[model samples]
Target: MDLANLHFQNPEAFFLLLLGPLLILDWWWHAHKRKSTIKFPALAIAKKAAKGSKVRARYIVPALRMAALCCFVVALARPQNATEVEYTSTDGVDIMLALDVSGSMGTLDMLTRTDQAKLGVMNAEKVLKSGRFWDYSRLGYAKNVMAEFVQKRESDRIGLSVFAGNSYTLVPLTLDYGALLEILQAVDDSSASGNGTAIGDGLMNSLARLEKSDAKSKVVVLLTDGIDNASLVPPLHAAEVAKALGVKVYTIGVGKKSGTFLAFQQNPWTGEISWGEQPIPAENSLDEKTLSQIASSTGGRFYRAESKDDLEKIYSEIDGLEKTEIQTIAYARYQEKFYPWLLVGALLILLELVLANTRFVRIP
Candidate 1:
C-alpha cells in the first residue's frame, strides 16, 4: 500500500480534531482562573528559589497530550491507502489493412513536399542533389498516413498485410498499436517481392487473417495504386468470398487520374539506351471498375485519392465510420493505515503519563 494515496473510510470522524484545541483552551482558561499572586518586597530569597525551580518544563506534558489526542482523532477517521484498478471489455472492430508494395509504388509522382506538408505528413526524406527538398514516394506517403490512422484507433484490433507478386501477413490482429506502427514504418517497395500487383491475393491474405476473428465487426481496407496483373485468383472472386463470409471491404485507389510516367527503352543491336516520358492512361493503369465492384460487393465504399490531402480525408472518413464499443470496470483495493496511528497515539499518551508522574509531578 502506498502512503501517497492515503484516504479515510470514515472521513466524518475528522470532526474530532476540533476537540484537541477546545481541550487546550479549557486547560488554559482554568489555569488562568487558578492563578494567584502574592506581594513580596524585592526579597532576594524568593528570587533565588524561583530560579532553582523547573516550572517552565511542565508545559511539555500538555503539548504531548494534545499531540496524542490529534493522532487518536486521525486514527478514528479510518485512514487507508487505496489503489484503483480498471478492467476493460470491448466488442471492438477487427480491421486488416491490406497494402500494395509493388514496384509501381515507387513512383515519384505523389512525392511533392508541398502536398505532403499540407497533408501533415511526418518524417519525409528530402531528395537532395543540389541541396533542395524532395517529395516522398507513393509508398512513403502511404506509410505515413497509415501510421497516423493506426494511432487513432485505441480499442480496435488492427492487423497489416502487404502484397505484390505474392501476399503475406506482416502483423496479425492485435491491440498492440506500437508494434503495428513499427512494422508499418518499415514497409517500402522492397518489403515485398516486387514482381506485379496482386489485388485478389492481397484481399485473400487479409481474409485469411480475419477468418477466426470473433469481433462484432470485421473489415478490410485495401489500398492500391495499380491494376491487378499477377493475381492467380481474379479480384471479383475474392470479393465474392468476402461477401459470403460477412466481411466488408473498402477499396482505395491512389494517384492522379491521368499523368505521364517515364518509360525507358533499350536498343539491343546498337547497345544504346533511350528514355522518354509517356502518357499513362489512368483507365489502363488503374482497374477502378474492379476495385469499385469489390467494395460494393461486400457492402463497402470505394474511394479515389488523387492527392495526399484526399488520402488523409479518406482515412479520416473511415475512422468515423468504424467505431469500437468498449466497457470499463474499475475497483479499488485499500489497506488499513489506522493501526500505526493508533499505536503512535497510545505511545504518546503513555509517555505523557510517565513524564507527568515522574519529572513533572504536580502537588496541590
Candidate 2:
C-alpha cells in the first residue's frame, strides 16, 4: 500500500471528530463550578501543598480517550490507496523493405564518402588499408541507411526481402527490429549468388509477405540499381497484383549519372599486375519508367537517389508519409486501507481503558 496515495472513501464519517473538544469543555466547566467550602483560616498553606502534588497528572486519561476517539473516526472514513495503470492499443502499419543485392551493388561510385561528417564513414585510405572491402560499396551504404531507418519506426511491423536473379524473404513482418537489422547487416553482394537482377520476383516476394497482413495500411519500399534481367514474373503483372492486394509500392533507384570503374593492367616482361580507377560513363540500367509506373499504379511515389544523402532523405520522406496510429487508456485500482486503521484505533482505546483503570483512575 502506498501511503502517499491515501484518501478517505467515506469522508462524511469525520464529523465525529467534533465530539472530543465538546467533551473536554464539559469536563472543565463542571470542575470549575463544583467548589468545596473550607472552615479553617489561612488557606494559602493548603493551596501551596496541592500545587506541588501529582493531582494534575490525572488529566492524561481524558487526553488518551480523546485521541482514541479521533483514531476511530478516521478509521470509519475508510482510507484507501489508489494505483494507476496505463495501456496502449496501437494500430500500426505493416511495411516490407525489398532490397536488390545484384553484383552491380559492389560499385564504388556513391559508396565513397568524401565528407566524413555526413555519413560517418571511415577514411577511404584507412578502409583500403584495413582490408574492409565492402565498406566502399553501394550494398554497404544501403544496409547502413536501412538499419538507421528501422530504428526510427517504433510501432510499425517491418519485414525484409532481398533479390538478385532470385528473391528470398529474409524476415517476416515483426516488431523485433533488432533481429531484423542483424540479418540486414549480414547481407552482402554474395547474399544473392546469381548474376542477374530479378525485380519482378522481388516485388512478388514482398507482396507475398504483405498479402498476409491485416493492417489498415500496407506498404513496400523497393530499392534497386539495375534493370530486371532474370525473373519468372513480369514487372507489370507484379504491379497489377500489388494494386489488387491494396498494397502501396514505393520505388527508389540508386546511382549517379557518371562514376568511376576499376581498370586493371599486367606487365608482360615483369609478370606483375596493377589496378587503377578510370573515369567512365555510369551505366544506369535501372528501368526508371517501369519503376515509376509501378509506383503510380499502386498509389505510391518513385524517388531517384544519386548519393548516400539522397537515399537517406528519401527514406526519411517515406517515414514521414507512413505514420503509425496509437491509442492509450488509463485507469486506477484502489486497495482498502481501513483494516489497519480500525485495528490501531481499537488498540488505542483498549490501552486507554487499561491505563485509566490502573495508573490514572479517579474517585466518583
Backbone clashes for every candidate come to 0, 0
Predicted candidate 1 versus true structure: per-residue lDDT over 73-164, tens digit per residue: 88988889888999999889999999998877766566455754543432222222221222265677788888889999988999999999
Give me the displacement of residue 275 in model 2, in angstroms.
Answer: 4.2
Q: How do the predictions measure up, each by TM-score?
A: 0.68, 0.83
lDDT of each: 0.82, 0.82
In candidate 1, position 162 carries an lDDT of 98
lDDT of 2 by residue, 147-178 (tens): 98999999999999999999999999999999
Q: Which stretches of candidate 2 lie over 4 Å from their true place?
A: 1-4, 29-48, 51-53, 113-131, 259-275, 278-283
- Cα-based RMSD of the predictions, in order? 7.1, 4.3
**Clashing residue pairs in candidate 2 (N, C-alpha, C atoms within 3 angstroms):** none
Q: What is the model-wide C-alpha lDDT for candidate 2? A: 0.82
